[model samples]
Target: MPDIERKFKCSSVPYPPIISCIALLISMRAITWIGFIIWLVIRLIIYFIYGRKHSIVQNESKD
Candidate 1:
């Protein structure tokens, strides 16, 4: 059998307009204020669940 290469592609996402318009007024803003806030909330939940393990690894690498 011959070897074949597969490529990965990402599709564009539609951000909501209301909060996003504020972000567009700024430069290089991907998600507007609403997106940013939503992201933070998700990140906080992930960190609360996994932060301890990551902190241990970070400390070991630093020292």
Candidate 2:
């Protein structure tokens, strides 16, 4: 049978590990921000095109 010793025995916070984790978190945040900006630009472009087309169609129908 495997011994189920205390899990906290080796739970020491090391500098490199902490720094790596912080860097990883920062990178993840940056990636998310970039994706959000890209998505926003795409949505705006699509909406603008749709709006222009809609107005043109409406004007044609009125004439």
Candidate 3:
């Protein structure tokens, strides 16, 4: 599962930061901030709900 997650993140994560950088240069409007806030909230919720439970360090310590 961790391997799969690593693979997925490798493919997906880098693009978002790049895209967000571009998006920021394109606009600093209200909607962009709103969307960023919503994205952050969702990320936090997911981290608390799932990521914290399934983290690699926690799994390794069990072994």
Query: Which of the numbered candidates is closest to the native, going by highest TM-score?
Result: 2
- In the order shown, the candidates' Cα RMSDs to the true structure are 10.0, 12.3, 11.8
lDDT string for model 1 (7-59, tens) is 75345435456458756577555556679889999999999778766788776
**Model 2 lowest lDDT segment of ten:** 4-13
Ranking of models by lDDT? 3, 2, 1
> Model 1's lDDT to the true fold?
0.72
The residue-by-residue lDDT of candidate 2 on 1-63, one tens digit each, is 467776665556587799998887777877797998999999999999899878977779988
Position 40, candidate 2: lDDT: 100
Model 2 lDDT, full chain set:
0.84
**Per-residue lDDT over 1-63 for candidate 3, one digit per residue giving the tens place of the 0 to 100 score:** 544545333568788999999987688888878999999999999988797788999889999
TM-score of each: 0.33, 0.46, 0.40
Error of 3 at 26 (Å): 12
lDDT on C-alpha atoms for all candidate structures: 0.72, 0.84, 0.84
